[model samples]
Target: MATTAEYNLGDFTYPRGWFMIGLSSDATQTPLAVRFFGEDLVLYRGASGKPHLVGAYCPHMGTHLAKNTTSYVVKDGEHVQGDSIRCPYHGWRFGPDGQCDDIPYSPKAPPKRACISTKKLVERAGCLWFWYDEEGGEPDYDLPEFEGYDEPAWVNWNVRCLGELDSHPQEVIDNICDKGHLEPVHGSLNMELFENEFEGHVARQILSAGHKTLAADGGEPMTNDTWYTGPGILQSKMIGEFPSLMLIAHTPIEDGKVKVWYGLSVKVQNTEPTEEDRALAAGYEEAGVDAFAQDFEIWANKRPCLNPMMVEGDGPFDKVRIWYRQFFNPRARAGEFQKRVNGRYVVRGTNTHPWDNAA
Candidate 1:
C-alpha cells in the first residue's frame, strides 16, 4: 500500500529477474498459488505437458483460482483430459492459460473477454519464471552464464529453501555487499577485502575467503560479483564474472511480505558429486540462511521500513547500499545514468541524487 512517492527518498528502479515461486515439491498434483511482483499467480501444468501461469483470482466474481480445489487435468493439445481444475462456486472451467473456457450457466457460450491475465512463463533449470513487467521495451537480459553447470570439471548440486523475513529486499542485498560481517556472522572465514566497484544498478566485490583454494597455491582470491538487476533479481558469481558462475537471488515484496529464492550454481567434474563437496556447499548455504535470519530479526523490530531513512553511519557498507538505491531508484531521471563500455552503470561520482541535475 506504500505508494512509490511515499517510499521515494531518492530515485531507484525495481529490480527485475525470473523468480522461483514454488519448488517441484509444492506443486505435484494440485495447482499452487505463489505471490510475485505484488500479485498472486496460480501455477499448473497444462494438458499439453507444459507449465502455465495464470491470475490467482477468478475474473467472474474474484474467487481465487486455488479455491477450485480440483486437480489439474493432463490433456494433450486437443481436449481436456483427467484432473482438470473447476471452480467449486460455479463449475467454470479454466485452462492453464487462465482462460474461462466453460460457463455451465451460460447458454450462449462464455464471453471472449472472460479470460484471466496470462503471464510470460518460462521453466528452466528445474524452476519456473514469469515476466512480471511490460514487454518489447528490451529483451529480458540473459541469465549470467555459469561454467560446468551441465559440463565437466567440478561437481554441481543445488538446494532451494523458502525464507520469510520482516525486512525489505534491499536489506537482504546489502548482506551480499557487507564484507565486514562475514567474520562475525559466518564464523570468520578470514575473508580479505579487495576492490569495490559500482556500475549502473550492479555492484561487484572482489574478495578472497581463506577456506576456498585457487590454482595450485591453495590460497587465492575468490572473485565474487554481486549484481542488482532492477526490481527483484540479485545475482552473484564466484571466481569470475562469467555466466556459468552465476547465483541468482530473486526477492519480491507485496503488502509487507517478502519472499526470497536463492539459486546457486557450482562447477562440477565428470564424476558423481562427492559427499564432502555436498557438505561444503550445504555449509555455505546454511551460513547464508543464518545471516538472513539475523537480519530478519533486526528488521522486524524496526519502526518504519529500513530504506530512504537510513542514518549516516548505521551501516558501514552504506556505500554499497547507496549504490544499490541509485541503481534501482525508479525516480532516477532518465538519460542521467549511462552504461560504460564494459556494460556496467557509469557512476558520475558519490552523489546519490542523480536527478538533482534535472531541470
Candidate 2:
C-alpha cells in the first residue's frame, strides 16, 4: 500500500477541490463527525438551514466536537445552538467560522488562539460538499449544479453512502478516460464517440454507449455526457428513455483510502409518475450503482498504478493524469503544469455535448 506522496503527484498530499463529505441529510441539529482529506471534521446544519463544516476537536481542550457520549451540551438531544456548537468537555461555543465566541467558564473574552479551523461547506444536488485546499483559501470554482434537482419533473433517490474503501482516489479518477475498459469492465456495446475536453479546472467526456440491461431489445444508442467540476465531483447525464443525472464523488480519507458517494435523479414522464414509471426509476438507480460497482471491484483488487503503461487505445490517460496533477500543486504552480499539458482532446467524435436534448 503506497501513499499518495509516493506517486509524486505534487507538494500537497490531497488534491484541492470541492469534495463530497456527506449527504445533505447527514447534517441535522446534531453534529456529525466526518473524516475527509485525512482530517476529522464536524458537520451540522444551523438554525438558518445552512451547512457548517469545521475541525472536529475543540481548540480549548482538544475534545471531539460531535462525539460526546454523556449528556453535556446537548439540548433536546441535539448539541446545536443557533449556528454555533458548544464543546461538550468545557462548554466553549464555536461559530461557523471556527472561532470561539463564548467560554462559559471564563469571564474574560476568549483568546484569539481559541478558534477551530473551518472549511467552506455548500449543500447542493442532495449532498454536502467542502472546499479543501492546503493553502486554506476560498474555492477556486463552484460545484456543478443540475437544474432538474429543483424542478417538479425530477425525482431523486436517497444518496448512497459507500463508506470508506482501502484504495487511492486516483484509481477511481482514472476511469473517466479509460475507454478501453468499457466493453470489458462495464459491458457496454458500440462504445463510440469517446472524447474529452479540458477547460480550466473542469473536464468532460462524451460518448454514445449502450448496455444490455438498459435496453431489452438488444440495445439502443444512448448519449452519455459525463463531466467533472473539479478533481472529485463527477456528474453524468444519460439520455435514453428519459433524462437522468448521476453523481459519483470520491474523497480521500487517508493516504491510500477513499470515501465514495453515489446519487441519481430521473425525469418523470408526467408531473406525477405512474407505478410503472416509479419502477423504471428504481431500476435506473440500481443499474447506475451496479455500473459503478464494476469499477470499484477492479480498483479494490488491483495494484496501485504509480506509473501507468498506457497504450494508444487507452484514451487520453496521460493528458488526464497531468490535468489531475494541477490540483495537487499550489495554484501558483498549476500554471506551469497546465502549460506543459493542458488542452482539449477529442477522438472518434466532436466535442459537442450529448445531453442537449436531455437537459
Candidate 3:
C-alpha cells in the first residue's frame, strides 16, 4: 500500500471531488457505519427519506454514533428522528448538519461546540455522493447527471456495488489513457483510434476499437467516449447494438485503499421497457460488468505504479498522471497542472482521424 505522498501527487492526501460513498439502499432509518477518506462515518435517511452523511463519533464523549444495537435509543426506534440521528450510547441527537439538537440528559442547551463533522451529500443514480475537499470548500465540479437513469427507452441501472479494493484509486484512474491495456487485458482486438483530451477538471478518452468480449464478430468497431468529472466519477458512452452508458466511481477508504462501483444503463428498442426489454438490458449490463471486472481484478492484484516506464503506443500515461494531480493539489493551483496537459494527443498509427483535425 503506497501512500499518496509516495506518488508526490500534491499536498493533500485525498483528492477533492464528488465521491460515491455508498449505494442509495445503504441509507435507511437504520444508520450505516462506513469508512471513507480515512474517517468513520454514518449514513442514514431522515423521516423525509433524504440521506445524510456525518462523522461517526459523537462530539461529547467519542461514542460511536451508529455502532450500537442494544441501547434503548436504538431499540426504542429513537435512533433516527426526522433528519437527525441520535447517539446509540448516550442518546445525544444530532441534526443532518451535525449540530447537537438535544442531549437527552442535559438541562442546559447543548454547547455550540458540540457537533459532529458532516459531509455534503446528494442521492442520484442509485448511489450516495459526497463532496470531499481538503480545503473544506464546497464542490468545485458538478456530478454527472447519469442521464437516462430513470427515463423512458432506457432500463434504470441497479448499480452494482462492487465494494472495496485495497489499492489506491490512482491505479484505477490510469485506465482512461491506458490504450496499451485494451488489446491484451480487455480483448480490444485491432484498435483503430485512441486519443485523449485534457480539459479543465475533465479528462476524456475517445476510442474506436473492437473487443472480443463486448462486441459482435464482423460488426462495426465499438466507439466509446469516456471521461472523468473531477476525479472520483467516470462515465463512458458506448455505442453498440444497444447504446449503453457505463459508470465507474472510486473513492478513498483510507490513504492507500479505495472503494469502487460499476453500473450500466442500456437504451432498449422501445419507448417503455417491457419485461423482455428489461431482461435484455440486464444481460447487457451484466456483460458490461464482466468487462469491468477484467480491470478490477488487475487493480486488486498489482502493485502501485508510481512511475510508469513509458514506452511508445502507451496512449500518454505521463500526461494522464499530470492531469490527475490537479485533484490532489490545492484548487487554486489546479490550473497549473491542468495547463500542462490540457490538449488532444493522438497516438501514431491509430489512423481513425485526419492528422490535422481530431474531429
**TM-score of every candidate:** 0.69, 0.91, 0.96
Higher-lDDT candidate of 2 and 3: 3
lDDT of 2: 0.81
Q: State the lDDT of candidate 1 residue by residue for 189-242, as single tens digits.
A: 434443356555455655455433332343443445656554455556566422
Residue-level error in angstroms, candidate 3, position 332: 0.6
- The per-model lDDT (C-alpha) reads 0.51, 0.81, 0.88
Best by lDDT: 3
Rank ordering of all candidates by lDDT, starting from the highest = 3, 2, 1
Better of 1 and 3 by lDDT: 3
Deviation in Å, model 1, residue 111 alpha carbon: 1.1
TM-score rank order: 3, 2, 1
Query: Candidate 1: where is the Cα deviation over 4 Å?
Result: 1-16, 24-29, 70-85, 134-140, 145-147, 153-156, 187-192, 209-223, 229-231, 239-248, 268-270, 274-359
Instruction: Name the top TM-score candidate.
Output: 3
Q: Tens digits of per-residue lDDT for model 3 on 1-359?
A: 78999998989999999999888999999999999999999989999989999998998789998898999999999999999999988789999888998988989999989999988999998999999999999877788889898898999877877988988888988999998788778788667888899999999999998777566783358899999998999999988778989888898999989988888889998988999998998898888888899898998999889999988677788998999899898899999998999999887546565445545
